[model samples]
Target: MAPACEPLPVQLGAPSTADPHARYARLREAGPVHPARLPDGTVCWLVTRYEEARKALAHPCLSTDPAHASPKYEHPPWEHGPPQALLAEAAGRHVLHSDPPAHDRLRNLVNRAFGTPRSAFWRRDVERIVDGALARLAGRDEPELLSGFALPVALAVISEVLGVPHALRARLEESAEALVTVGGRPATPNAARAAAGEVIRLMTGLFREKRAAPADDLLSDLASAADEEGGPLDEGDLIATACLLLFTGYETVAYALCNSVINLLVRPDQLAAARASPALLASAIDELLRFEGPGDSAALRYTTASVRLGDVDIPRGECVLVSIQSANRDRCRFAEPERLDISREPGDHLAFGHGIHHCVGAPLARLEIEVALHRLLTRFPALRLAVDATELEWHHLMPLRSARSLPVRL
Candidate 1:
């Protein structure tokens, strides 16, 4: 093997989101860790195997904060537009990018307002939103599932939870699409900046509105804390948290739902089994996540100190990308990992991640998926792809797997 200081010639530019699993399988088979160069010309360690990926995710030295990055780490692997500093200034102070006490404080506030119990409480709202979307889909001759049904349902539920009025929901969705599609499409730098500006403008106004007239919603609760001395949030924290929620809350859920539907639709037996029993459907959710979760990897992690993962040694101040999708499908960890077995035991999947930074919205995402899938399948018994499955194109966004558009014949 070459010296740890020398990066391999192989480039892990962007995994083809449509069929990333085959590539991840090869990487995992080769070894647990590989030195790779990203598209932005950054050399980093990519963790491919299950055990190493899980440990790396929770490793103390692997930090999510950008401050821990090496001085030479110029470009962020995920985004191209705007300097990392500018993006950080706009939306980087949330729980996802902190450590220890600060992360605890921010996460605790989210949990208090949006925990499992709170997510369960939103079931009625989710069902109502999903049913309404399905109704609209029913009217169209050939509906685009991602935008027409899934995306709208996900956005509406989250908007209601955040106390966003009906008037602002469409605008919120547009700005969010702009922010997330940066990597997926060829977008100008200003696209992200403009979208960020719009989000900040709307959120700032909403924060003020919420403070003046508190409501029984997550935003109101967060805004209230920001008003107090030594409270959990400040203006920066609130805005950043809002960005985090807005981007992840709806986007990830919608993508996962689309992915799940695609998976089930292709496998007639799984679809039949899922529709046959609600209990089986619930168990199948994790299987679907393990088979093809929305995110291919967790957030980019930086090494605070030299660390050994498996047989490879990585130096301090370097980048580490852990493939959550690869880990979930590791044959060593899961028997017959490639097959989509809905009856397989559900725990230990890294779809929502592991450790302290595990997605706070797991419960909510799962709830949305269950409600949306159940309603969708029951509503359209003959639902099928409008075009051949092979013709569907997927977004190239790393860590996010989504079809560009899902056309369905209902």
Candidate 2:
């Protein structure tokens, strides 16, 4: 049990990009939870162990709302900007940032677009998008996979699915990058607001366009939603949902591909196994996600009431970050957790998170990875890392992890 008198707060910065799991392992052994201060200077409880983290993520008293943050915590610009800043607020208030009835309402409204049937419908489109990306990747020397292939595929898939205009796609990519930096980097508050504000503005315009001239896409479906399905989304709800979907779909899939690629390249046996067996490939992808999913932690959760987690009591209004990165690698929950074995049974991991707040886009993400990896490996069977594995750099962003670049020779 941790001492009742809390020790000095652990200053939490981004872990070493090269191998963060090592850091998380030490933190888990230290305690189930720690009083920590974020690089941005916000203080919170950091949950590290598997059972404690799972419970913390699912606990109803732990909220995703900024309103529950302690007074000592300085709110981000997106949370309390000017009234004309509704776009910023909306971006901050997306499905990931609400609780209870509001969370349920937003989730239900957004689910109509990402339901199982809709995801199934996306497979052929995803393969088309992947094929097009692969075509562009040919005839390049030492091509950087992150920019050359992975990101473009992810961006194209989301754009096609949402019917984003070609003209707005580049700007959408820029804004999404800024949002990721805002999520993990020590970005200035004003810069964060500007980035989020720009995304909201873009999404707002798209929502209106979809409403005026509906297309057979998710954005159109959301824009033209009627009260029968769920009340029509207001400007804020529409923009927020669009931004959330765009940013999430864009960020996670791109990194997961890069991470999976690097993971396989380092171990040829695993790569050969994945390429040879579709069944093994499916299992391997899940294992890769569990081993190195994009999310290091879920969005910061606020405690609505005092909650006890593994001998430590988190008081009301405090922030809690359940480290998905740590919990998935927990030895208690996984046998020989450090070893990456694609043949093992897929275990429930918090990569997409747990409980009501679990990621709704999980199916689409999986579909994209499966198609992209299959096509990529089959097309370029001789592909190998252009740079030494240790020389590779990772993006040390919180709530996400990915290589900065993956130079490959085809």
Candidate 3:
């Protein structure tokens, strides 16, 4: 069983300083669903235990639409001074924000882009990018692996998949990184909002161009997406989807890649096991993803009706945040859940998500992480953390990931 620790009571929205998984474990011990609030003072529930979270995530009574589920709900703004239309579109229309028929409509349109055969094509490019980046680091004394190697590989593959122009890719990537990573520095509401707006503006322009002159890119494909009836998604939905693809699409993979590399570096036994047997690489990636998945609570799922989750009757219209991290570590769900064991066989893991909203890109994500870890370990057999592992700074407060940079010597 995980150790017991209770979070000190604080204002509903205040960020916790303790490690995120530790916080989740503590919260899970308390109960499956606990009360919390968004930064903008909206009351919400945190669903922490494995079974409750799995059920809650797929429960029809729960909703992803904040507008309908919790109309009065307010969230900290991603950017200031943006037009309300842009903000509203961003807030309400994406595939992540819809439920049921609407969610299926939006998801179906974009799902083919990530189909198995399509992902295979992407994997080739991903490998090429990973190889090129590693080659660049061949003779360097020390290269910050996250920035120099991992981030570039993710950006290159995603950009190519999205059909971002070579000329505009750099700027687009910078703005997307700012929006996704929150400046790739310390995060604050204002900074995060500005980053979001900047990326939104760039995507808006790209969408406009693609609609006018269709190209052979993801944007072009989305630009022309239509059913025999009217289009399934509107202009706003397209923009939101595009932004979602670019912004969210790369961050998780990058974090997992960095985290996996760091884990191998620190745990020599596991590292040696992986290096000794190529067959172990795939298992190591899956375990790494489960042990330290980059994502946090599902963005928003409010109760439409009074719902009973683990004996707690959450009132109607209350927002619920399902902790993917917490569920993965629940002892009842896995034997010795706290410990990392690559030999463990596959089981139900919520690292990506569950039910109707399971991540569309799980296949691609696994491919990237597996390929990156295998190549990095093989190429840099002597790879070691340049600074002490304790000395490496972690961006713990962010909901998306814990580490900012993983500095290493080749």
Error of 3 at 284 (Å): 2.9
Question: Comparing 1 and 3 by TM-score, which wins?
Answer: 1
Per-residue lDDT tens digits of candidate 2, residues 1-410?
Answer: 55422354766655465687887787778889988777677777889899999998899999877778778765641221122134436544666777878678778767877773666679898999899989888988779988788888898898888889889988987866655542234345576567777777787788888888888788887677633354554567556766777767886789899889999889999999988987778667789999888777777788889999998988998889888889999999999898888897888888988988898888889889988998999999998999999988776656667777789999
Query: Which runs of model 3 end up more than 4 angstroms from their true locations?
Result: 1-18, 37-42, 69-92, 182-195, 212-216, 227-232
TM-score of 1: 0.92
Pick the winner on TM-score between candidates 2 and 3: 2
Task: Mark the regions of model 2 whose C-alpha exceeds 4 Å error after superposition.
Answer: 2-8, 74-92, 177-195, 226-233
The Cα error of candidate 1 at residue 251, in Å, is 1.3
**Candidate 1, residues 1-410: lDDT per residue as tens digits?**
32332336446546353577787777777788988776677777888888999999899999988778888875445532232223356855777778887788778778888853556669899989898888877767798888777777878888888889889977988876776642256346678778777877888899789989998888887788775656546677766776677667777888899989998888999999988888889778999999988886788889999989999889999999888888999999999999998999996999898888998888888889998898888989888888888887886556677787888888
Write model 3 residue lDDT over 199-297, tens digit each, in one string. Answer: 667777877788789776677777777432554567777677766666556777788788888877888888898888878888667788788887766
Distance from true position, residue 241, model 1, in Å? Answer: 1.0
Whose TM-score is greatest here? 1
Check candidate 2 and list the clashing pairs: none
On a 0 to 100 scale, what is the lDDT of residue 10 in model 3?
A: 15
- Candidate 1 least-lDDT 10 residues: 79-88
Clashes of each: 0, 0, 2
For candidate 2, the C-alpha RMSD (Å) to the true structure equals 3.5
